[model samples]
Target chain A: MSVTGAGRPRLATKKRPGDTAREEILDASAELFTTRGYTNTSTRMIADAVGLRQASLYHHFSNKDDILDSLLSGTVDEPLAVGQGIQGVEESAVVKMYAMAWFDADQLSRSRWNLGALYLLPELRTDRFGSFRESRFTLMNLYATIAGGVVQELESDVSAGTEELPFRLVETIVNGRADTENGRGSAGLHHASLIATAAVRVLGFPGDIDGIHDRAVRVVADVTASSIFEKKAGHGQ
Target chain B: MSVTGAGRPRLATKKRPGDTAREEILDASAELFTTRGYTNTSTRMIADAVGLRQASLYHHFSNKDDILDSLLSGTVDEPLAVGQGIQGVEESAVVKMYAMAWFDADQLSRSRWNLGALYLLPELRTDRFGSFRESRFTLMNLYATIAGGVVQELESDVSAGTEELPFRLVETIVNGRADTENGRGSAGLHHASLIATAAVRVLGFPGDIDGIHDRAVRVVADVTASSIFEKKAGHGQ
Candidate 1:
């Protein structure tokens, strides 16, 4: 790609691991943005980190907003697709819910940078990120629908409040990850599993959770092996 | 009290509703920080918004961070004290959980500005806000304690995942409030009540929720009436 200036002369500095120069810039941006704060990270710093010229970086992305949008989109799209796939499957609501939360939480927990922490950026409330917000809204709706099914199976008014809690519950992984990253606390490696079970539990799913967890694990693995999750090594490589 | 610059001549501009000049500055800062963003807002803009000279503004706060720290502290203290008070009272785990959440959600919901939205400000990661972060940490621990009690009352493995979730669930009001403010989706006026109920339900509280709600409502009102919450009428008033 011309943006990467592939087959061009080398800048010859410390290079980051990425299949392409664009990916390298994204990887650098992710580290700097999350660690240094998004408002504080600059395009020049990203270029320096990736050993690319600023002109070369601009060719791939128009501005810092583009890089942020691309990184944020990569985080949401796979989970939305995986959740949608789990929805049509001939599985119980518990499995569908658990699978969705588990897969979503796993990806958020495993992302190279805790980009999920950026969801609350005041900048995101603007029209520029309408699509990201909508995708997230769709994801929330999917969670509510699956949670609604779980509530129906119980035939009780357990989670009679907002069905949005399941989605909200899974997102705590974002906060937990941020806390751990900040050295405030350690949310053990099992946080994804813990948060997944808690997501359904908040919906009052009072059945064999271990069974649901087992099935969900398989569901997540199937989706991960599919072409969807393997969509590149992903943004931050 | 000197922060108010008492007996000083008034400036002719738009005035915010506050009993004191210090509170007025905080009120304006909360609005600017949450809406325009902490990083983007300058003290000069805040001074202009509140009709104060930049030099006079410095008398009350050293910098933007000082104003931010004061605004952030106001939101956390009342909830922490109320939760602590609830712990000492003879109440069921459900009652305690619901009451703590309802009171917290109410304040977070009713705040003049969505200051809770600023919690994720990347600037907060610094050690300069350590006391504020420590206070928040204490409040979270209190939530976990109340949530743990609810988990124990069930005597089931429902919320074995994380006691931290009940606090996390209540905090979603922050995100929900932001969403509603942005005109994305209306979370409803009853979001505080709904989220408080869900916060407990997440811990598997399965009996007589209406009764718990009734008691919790009364408890929250008592705390609101107390001199503790009435302390200075809060910042961003």
Candidate 2:
């Protein structure tokens, strides 16, 4: 709601001379895209928000599609990279899954996440977003892989329901919050841990639920708070 | 995408004299509302799509808001009514939850559910849809009520995690499909069963997963296909 930058004229002011139009446009567009959805947001509105005339806005990008392309790459591509990073780690699959969910949640809590939610809108599913869709499914597949490991370790049969259930459970928990105005702030991390716990439970992990809950919370916090999940996970703290 | 009804212009020709203008208008609006979103969809475009001049469309609806209000009551109000009907039933809370998830999924699978999905659009979440929002939360609270019953029946300590997990889990599965152009058709019922199974599992239900899944499928089909989950379930089913 505070994103409109009210009363700030589109003219280049002397005091804020360092701000580039591209960055300003991106910032303004992100706010509108998250708060008002991609389709409802007009280029003129974005220009008006950033204090630029609609014609001047064309200097930076050809049209709205160009702006959306930039936003998609900027916001969505990183998490896919993070998912890929987690995939190459030497840690156990359960730990990798925890790290993925944890970091993914933290990244989603950031302001850029509003742009990511745009991927969910029906109108935005054009070929222009094909890579975003691919990356998203890749990320989901990573969760399924980690979850499948847990099912194997537990010796449970991979029934039709159980195969996709854990991934969907994790997705529901994470994506459910994507639409809220401001992300959960401090509670986002807690929700991430809770999602991890529920996800493991859905996989039929048989440890003590409370103990797993406590350990899972700490594991996600530690993993997301550090770069260890990306490199080799270092233990012995 | 067939929702556009591209070549099928609105006409009162002898061949289609039975089709009412109101129904055609609603159908066209629902298609545009779901695909292009409410804000992006204009009355002019809607009129054109329905083969009416922009001015003539006003005879049926004063504005887009009136059209949206009718769409809400037509498509979304039924689910709310179904939820209310379920609330008055005498079946077990767990059973009610399954029945709710099942019928809700079935209703969502109907083509009209696309209009229901438009409620998720940020632009559409205005004062006009306040009743829709209230009805939505009331339906969610029904799920919460049922989940709470499972928690109490099992005497498990209710933590923050389990409190809303079941409702969200069911929502993730059901609402997740709302964006699909065609409801899963025959596969939709299977997905509904899977959603019911997962929702109950989230509540820590101890029954056989497959058995519960089968029963949930049958219960939902019966409730949705017939009116049994209401009047008949008012006794004991």
Candidate 3:
């Protein structure tokens, strides 16, 4: 307990409404859960970090598992939504793949890659996360569609091999970089271009590489600008 | 405890020499450490898995940290040696990269991938693993050298970008596949070919992709055949 000058426990500000309370709890838990394993963190620690009385914390979340569910759900839904949006946009198949890769890497960077990395733990592998796994499978299939389309259009001899391999390659690049201590810091605007470029090359896209890089950068910039504007307008908030 | 027909604790065979005992302990610990995590697993559990009494286990190693050091050291040394051998081999830069990637993916697959995944755990990120980390760094630098040579010889406008990215990409594919329930069973000769193909492309190698893929397969097959012959001759055992 933090004590004020008079040695009394400092009062927390008046509690927020349930939605705000839930958001704050999730924001705090995501960081804690990423740095410390979910099992190692406790509800009490989360409550303390968020300045909520222990009993009050339950108003927003019933338990740690509930918070994890929310966190994992939020992390996947945005990129997958963005990916689905890209498919609706009229663009070349290669451009769409670059746009999705760029968007996904940007989203992962914003989430502090560690949050996405939580799935890697064996403890989190259970039937309860089956929905989460399904959502991810859907997202990868979306990527594979864009990649396979390009391969079919470009070369008849090559099959683009397997959908799973390309998807896994893109994932490997993202998560592998995330494992580095400085990975987050290094994932700036240009890094998204690097990721997109690498993604296409791994898919065996036989296109103009330089042109793809330029278009990917523009797509990422436009999306980021729009999202920033939305946040500023209090829509995302 | 495993129950026997007579319902008494089964008598373990008399203790082997220290070398054999250490190897058994490491073998048991690798599986337990990978599945249960190093921190969650106890020395007692490891000893039990290896058919050693808890006290007798201590005679071979001081504690869990020592056991972990041995396990990590063994895992890194084989691949590092193989990587170094590739560096010394007189081959084209692309061939060397493919050989290194093929050897690494094969070695990691043989070790069940969990052995490499242990480095991702926060608890293992300590000074004790400095030598292990250095050996890995050396191996990556060797890869970067080959990659740089390929990029320079092929494209004047292209930069090698970051050496770390390609290395991490390879690791991500290996570990990501490893996370699947039946990942080990899925890793066969064709998968190694797929990994090598993706690896060189990600490095921006402007060679004939088919030619590189064919050479990579031959290199991997030759190596695998030689290793099996050695094992049959009781050299590797």
Instruction: Output the lDDT of residue B206, model 3.
Output: 50
lDDT of 1 by residue, B1-237 (tens): 223564245565448867677888898999888888787899999988988888888888899999999989888887887788788778888899999998888888888888877776677888998899888889988988888888888774753546777777778778777777666564743367877877776677766678888999887777667775567344322
lDDT measured at residue B44 in model 3 versus the true structure, 0 to 100: 94
Off by over 4 Å in 1: A1-8, A158-161, A186-190, A227-237, B1-8, B158-161, B188-190, B226-237
True contacts preserved, each candidate? 0.40, 0.37, 0.18
TM-score per model for chain B alone? 0.91, 0.73, 0.77
Compared with the true structure, the alpha-carbon lDDT of candidate 1 equals 0.77
User: Predictions ranked by lDDT, top down?
Assistant: 1, 3, 2
For model 3, how does the per-residue alpha-carbon lDDT over B19-125 read when each residue is reduced to its tens digit?
A: 46666677788777777777778999987887777777787788998888877776666656566555665667778778777767666656643676566665555
* Model 3 stretches with alpha carbons more than 4 Å out: A1-19, A156-162, A173-179, A182-190, A214-237, B1-19, B159-162, B182-190, B213-237
RMSD of each: 3.0, 7.1, 6.5
Candidate 2: count of backbone clashes, pairs at least 3 residues apart or interchain? 1
Give the alpha carbon lDDT tens digit for every residue of A1-237 in model 2: 122233333564421222466767877887787678776789999887877778777877888888877776665455555656656656655666556665555555544435544655665556765665565556556666777777787776534545555545555533455424332222322366666656666666545556544554555554445574445332200
Best by TM-score: 1
C-alpha DockQ of every model: 0.47, 0.35, 0.29
Against the reference, the lDDT scores of all candidates come to: 0.77, 0.59, 0.62
Poorest lDDT segment (10 consecutive residues) of candidate 3 chain A: A1-10
TM-score for the A chain of candidate 2: 0.69
